[model samples]
Target: MNEIELTIEQSKIYNGVICPYCKGISEMIKSKEIYGKDYGWLYICKPCDAYVGCHKNSKRPLGRLANKNLRKLKNEAHRYFDKIWKLKILDRTKAYNWLSEQLNIPFDYTHIGMFSEKTCRTVVEISKRALNDNRRLDMDFGVEPVTEFFETI
Candidate 1:
């Protein structure tokens, strides 16, 4: 078998997380440098304008650095997926676990924050399918309607 070649971004030996745009190791900087207020720390690629926020007050990045388009996709994925738990269809942890199975990714790496654009799109498609399935079940069984269920919760 041939050996698989890893790109710079895919390699684990880099000193810091790679920027999706520039494919360079990112620099840790204050969020205020980009946001005008110190939201927290971030791993940033200044030339590419790609960045990822750190975990709360730490230097640890929440996920890979994303550009504007990736950021949009990530937000959209979260918007749809969050509803599964928000509507009590599944608890937050179970919802993530379900997403992990749907995406065929390991549970530990299933976070939307860490997903690429393709994965984010998959998340949106999976969530829409799940919501539709729930609606169909509700209708067929004459159980609580989807709209009413949301209103009551």
Candidate 2:
């Protein structure tokens, strides 16, 4: 390829950074799975990346969109709610006392009559599990070899 062509190719591949998890540069892996159907970011390994050739006409990213959004939201919410959640464990009595006073509920500082402790506990446990699972993928490179599962059109 000519120098200009090489530069263009380099620019396209370098447009985005590599996956923090696997240290792979994001690339537009070719697919025959069709346009919208074959959508997604593919992080290629260093050098040629050696992605499987696609006979189909489509491609897709392996990462979950929801997980990305959740991470962003979690980071933002942590700035505000981290204290409350920490207080919840370090000084449950004090946290509940503050809640009781702020809400003007009939419950006293000692009694958590205003909230369903069971329900709250369940929600917190489930949320914690979800967060843990999500964090596991924080450094994950998602799926590799876009051509492996590329649905042939």
| lDDT tens per residue, model 1, 86-150 | 98889999998898888887777677778889999888887877887887788999887553322
TM-score of 1: 0.80
Among these predictions, the greatest lDDT belongs to: 1
Give the runs in model 2 whose Cα sits over 4 Å from its true position. Answer: 1-115, 142-153
Instruction: Assess every candidate by TM-score.
Output: 0.80, 0.19
Query: Deviation in angstroms for 51 in model 1?
Result: 0.5
The collision pairs in model 1 are none
Model 1 segments more than 4 A misplaced: 1-16, 141-153
Model 1 poorest 10 in a row by lDDT: 144-153
In candidate 2, position 91 carries an lDDT of: 62
Give lDDT for model 1.
0.77
